[model samples]
Target: MSENNTRVIVITSGKGGVGKTTTTANIGVALANMGEKVALIDADIGLRNLDLALGLENRIVYDIVDVVEGRAKLRQAMIKHKQSQNLALLPAAQTRDKSAVNPAQMRQLIEEIRAEGYTYIIIDCPAGIEQGFRNATAGATEAIVVTNPEMSSVRDADRIIGLLEAQDLRNPYLIVNRLRPKMVKSQDMLAVEDVQEVLGSNVKLLGIIPEDEVIITSTNKGEPASATEGSLAGQAYRNIARRLRGEEVPFLDLEERSGFFTRLKGLFGNKK
Candidate 1:
C-alpha cells in the first residue's frame, strides 16, 4: 500500500480495564483477516500486553524501545501473527517507563512502519492521559475511543475525545464494549443511546460488543476472540473491521437471542 492509503489509528480509553488492548488486538486481527496488511504497536511501555494478547510473547526478541534506542531494526522488533501473514505486532518494553520514548520518536517509528507498506497501523495506547498517551497518538491519523456502558467509562471517554480534538484528531469514533442487554433491560446499565447522549452527537458509534465469555476464554489461550469462530463478540469485531474498510455493515442486534420481555415474564411467573 502507498503512504496515502495507510491509516495510522490509535485505540485508547481514558480508564483502565476498558478493553482497549483487546480492542486493538482483535481489530488488527480482524482487518488482517479481511486481507489488509496491519501493524499493531503496544505503546503502554512498562504495562505492555499486546504481545501476550496476540500470542506472540515467546517470539518477541526485540521491542519498540529497542528499535527507538538504535539497538534493533524495526523488522527485527515486529513479530508476525501466526494465523495471518498480513498482521504483525511491535511490542512495548516491560522494563521501561512511559518517559523512555517521546512523540517525535514515535512519529519516526510509525513512518518507518508506513514505509513498510502496511495498510493499517494500530496503536494500543496506555490507560490515562499521560506521556504514553501522547506517544501513542503522535502519528495516528485516526482514533478509536473504547469505553464501557457505565457512567465512569463514559465520563472518561468524553474527556479523551476532548483531548484528541485538542490535538487536532477530531471526530474520533466510539466503541462501546462489554454491554449487557439484560442489565440494560432492567434499567441497571446505560443503554447505547444513553451513553451516546452523554458523549454528544459528534462521536459516531462504530461498534457495540456484547459481553461474551468467549472473550475471556480466548484471551486465556493467548488468542484474540476475533480470530475464533462462533463468537458474538468476535463477529462484532469483524464487522467493525469491515466498517473501517468503508463497508456499510449494520450493527449487530444484541437482544435477539433472549427476549427481555420473555425473561421478565418467566421471572414473574416463577415467583407465583
Candidate 2:
C-alpha cells in the first residue's frame, strides 16, 4: 500500500485525433530507452490503440478489465515490450466499456504496479471529457494534456486543463502536436504563442511536435516514433521525456527557417 518512486502520468486529450495514444507510446519508449522502468496502461477500455502503437497487439491476452475483475493478476495481464526490457504495457479490453472499471479500481491497480518497482507508468487515456477520461486520470500523479496547434484542439485542451485542475491533478503540461510551420507562416494555422495565450498563464507548455510523415509511417508499422533515431517527432518526444524527468532540455525548433533563395529574394527587395 506504500508508494515507491513510481510516477503515474496520464496522457489525455479532450478531443479525439490529437495524438494522445501516440504520445503515450513514444514517451514510454523514450523513458525505457533511458534505462528507466516504464509501464504503459491503455485506459481507453472499449476503444484501444496503445497496444497497436507499441507493436504489442498480438501479445495481449488479459487486459485491464480482467485485472480489475480479479480474473487475472496484474503481472499476468502486463505485456512486456520485445525491444525494451524495461518497458511493459497493460492493454485495455476492446469489448468492455469505461464503466467496467472505476477510479478506485484504477488507483489500486496503479498502486500494485508501483509496488512492483516500476519507475514510470504512462496511462493512455481515452479522448473526450467523459467517464473514460475520469477513470484514466483518477490514479495519476501527473498529467500530459496533448493537443494540436489548432483552434478547436486548443479550446478542448483548455477545458481539459480546467477539469484536471478541478480534480487536483497538479502541473498538467501541454504538448502541441501536428504543428505545420509552413501553414503557420502562411497565416493558415495557429502559432504556438497563440495557443499559449489561449491556454492562459497558468498552463505550462511542455513541447511541440511538428507535422511529420514519418510519424504516420511509424504508427502504421506499429512502432513508436520515439524509438526511431532520425525522426523529428521522435526527437521531440525524447526531449519531452527528458523534461518530464526534470532535466533541462531545449524545445525543438519546428519552424522552417528562411533558405538561401528566400534570403536572396529578400535582399533584392522582393520579400515573399
Candidate 3:
C-alpha cells in the first residue's frame, strides 16, 4: 500500500525464546512514554502472550481476529495500556490458530491502525519463518530481529534477515538480548563482535539487552520493564526506541555496571 506518517515495525525472531515479545512491549511502552502514539499487535494468535507481557491479558475483550472478521471495530478491539495513554494493544485470539488470519488481512488491519494516526505500530511476530511469520510481516515498513548472544540464535537471525531482505522489507536491525558480559569476558560465550561477523557486515546493530532479573520479575508480574525506572533491560529498550526515532544513542555498556562495582572495591583496597 502507500507509505504514510505511521511506521509499521515487525519484531521477529526465527527461533523461540529470543525475547521478541518482550522487546515489542517495552519499545511500545517507551515510545508511548515519549508522547508518540504506539500500537502493539500480538500476531501469534492461538499462542498469544504479548498481552500478558504487557499486563493487559485481562483487558482484552476483542482482538485482531475480531476486527478482521468484522465482529468488532478496530477501536473496540484495541486495549489501551494503563501505563501510557498513548500506547494501545491489539491482541491476538487465544482460540484461533495462525492460519485463522492471512497476510492480506494482517496488512489491512495494520493499515487501519496506521490510519488511526499511530506514530508506530509494532507487530510481535511468532517464532520461525512460516505462515505466522508471513502474516506478521505483511504490512511491515521496518523490521527488528531480536536474538540472543549465541550461535543458534544468531544463525536464525541471519536466516530471518535474509527472508526480510528477499521480501524487499526495509533493512532489519538487530537487537541482541540476554547477553551476559561476564560470560563473553570469560570466553565462555560468543562476543558481540563475533555475532556481527557471522551475521555479515550489512546487518545493522540496534541495541543489546543484558540478562537481568528485572525482566523475569516484570514478566511474572505482567508488567513491562520499560515502565519501571532503574531497570537495565528497560533502559536498553528505551534506548532502542530512541534510536528508532532517528536519535543518536549509544549501544548500552553491558559491562559498565559490573565493572563499576569492581573499581569501587579496588579503590577501598578490598579487591578480591
Q: Best candidate per TM-score, number?
A: 1
List the candidates ranked by TM-score, beginning with the highest: 1, 3, 2
lDDT of 2 by residue, 1-272 (tens): 23567889999889999999999999999999988999999999999899999999999999999999999999999999999889999999999898999999999999899988899989999988998889999999889899998878888998999999988986688899998888888989998889988888777888889887878899899889888676678888989988988989877656532355543443364211
| Model 2 weakest lDDT span, ten residues long | 263-272
lDDT (tens digit, per residue) of candidate 3 on 231-250: 67887888888899999997
Model 3 clash pairs are: none
lDDT of each: 0.91, 0.88, 0.87
Runs in model 1 lying further than 4 Å from the true structure:
258-272
Listed in order, each prediction's TM-score against the native is: 0.94, 0.92, 0.93
Judged by lDDT against the true structure, how good is candidate 3?
Answer: 0.87
lDDT of 2: 0.88
Cα deviation in Å at residue 118, candidate 2? 0.6
> Can you give the lDDT of residue 223 in candidate 1?
88
